[model samples]
Target: MHLAHYLGLLHRSQANLASAFREVAAAHADEPDIEHLCLRQAAICDTHAERLHPFAERYAEEAPREPDRLHSTLFSGTRTGGIALLRDLQDLYLMASECDICWTVIGQAAYGARDRDLLATVRDGEGETAAQLTWLRSRMKQAAPQALVVAD
Candidate 1:
């Protein structure tokens, strides 16, 4: 019944995450790996949102008025420099973490509602979201030593 609210939340979150990823990718375009991977991940986020559309519409009638502050901005703009890249990745990790948890919560709801399609979508999205978090974490680790300990 209340699944629609979560579906909407997730849809918007995915869109936001995708946009942030693209922003970071463009800002850090000199980092080839980051640019390519961020763009790829953005596409994944878009796919996740696309998959959720039908479910959101199906449950729209049952959804109550969305509560205020259901959505919050995670990324403002990307920064420059090595340390900035690390910081930007940290921001991304946090955003991806939000998506990860939402996938989990929605997966549970899908099971309760016996929605196979939604569950499948959640499962796939969860894997991609986890990969995004892992990459962000690893990239941060790689950048930290150079950014923090080395003389600029």
Candidate 2:
């Protein structure tokens, strides 16, 4: 079943978001609130990843066990926040976007195949990532002004 492909994507998002969350937390350490939030989101991603692991095996399809190649999230900030923090935040937003897309893909596949279990799992994971993305976007809006204002 193509469920393997979907599961692979879910795992990839887990890995990327987990990495992004930790690194973004450290990269934007000046913002203690964001740092704490990323750390918390990372924990949630990890938990969901673990829960989805068993399903991957159950729906094994001999496909490659990786999807980061399809959608890379390995972001080493390009716009170094002051500027650095802003860039990292943008990357986190991108990752969150990817997470949303991945969840949507997984949901469509599972539901189309009438796999209720997979659909439910993906839905729950989607909610967690959505919360993280919503928070990140709100924080980004708050920080953009300070980041753009260059002082003499």
Candidate 3:
């Protein structure tokens, strides 16, 4: 597929992932730590979505939306049965993984593009997401094991 197509896909995926985090945060808002991290993740996803908007428009592609319950059901059902801290940790890790995928795709696009501005933007975004993922992973490690939520 073309670079624009790939970018569109990335944008949609990030949006859905962000939506999931928002849900998790809302579901466990009683916990400050979970709420804070989920809010941060939602903000990042919003930024990423905005960045991808122009590309989607330029390519005449529809951006991806948050999946409905049917889509989420394929994964683990709503993350419950865990301490608030662990639930947030799990959500963040999932978000990190989604961000990593976006980074990889954007990095590939940067390599293929001749446009310096586009390349630079994609590369920078990729780097930012990678750094965020690293930070989240580190925090996950430091948190209590029981706080880490995992989905099959």
Candidate 4:
């Protein structure tokens, strides 16, 4: 079934999000708030990974689970300043927005499959993700002035 494919892709995306979050937490030393948020998001992603396992197995249905690939969102070069951290946060926002789309797709699939568990989880996660998007946008607003200032 296509559930296997959807779950697989979602699982991989969550893992990458978690990795990026942890990396940002470590790399962006000056932005304590962003670091904390990233760590929290990483934990959420880990939870999502766990939540997805049974779904993947349940709907696999001889579909030979399409190989899950790591979609890397690596930011190259040395990290420095609030600007760098802001940019990282912005990138995360973009990823999260895309994830919003994935979640919507999952919801649609859930309706077709008539899977209550999948529907519930997708709906709950979508709300939580919306909160995350809001928080990230607020963080960006708070960081912008400091990030935009140049040394005199």
Winning candidate number (lDDT)? 1
Model 2 poorest ten-residue lDDT run: 70-79
Most TM-score-accurate candidate:
1
Question: Cα deviation in Å at residue 67, candidate 4?
Answer: 12
lDDT of 3 at 26: 81
lDDT of 2 at 125: 85
Candidates 1 and 4, the one with greater TM-score:
1
lDDT of 4 by residue, 88-126 (tens): 878778767766777889889999989999898898778
Error of 4 at 106 (Å): 0.5
Question: Candidate 4, residue 150: CA error in Å?
Answer: 3.9
Assess each prediction's global lDDT (C-alpha) against the native: 0.81, 0.75, 0.65, 0.73
Off by over 4 Å in 4: 61-71
Q: Compared to the true structure, candidate 2 yields what TM-score?
A: 0.85
**Count of backbone clashes for each model?**
0, 2, 1, 0
- Arrange candidates, best lDDT first: 1, 2, 4, 3
TM-score of 1: 0.89
Give me the displacement of residue 3 in model 1, in angstroms: 1.1
lDDT of 2 by residue, 1-152 (tens): 67677677777778777877888787666666977888988898898888788777888733454445523434744334276776777777777777688788888988888988888888898898888888888888887888888642
Candidate 3 wrong stretches, greater than 4 Å:
62-77, 83-88, 147-152
What residue pairs clash in candidate 1, if any at all?
A: none
At residue 147, give the lDDT of candidate 4: 85
- Higher-ranked by lDDT: 2 or 4: 2
TM-score for model 3?
Answer: 0.72
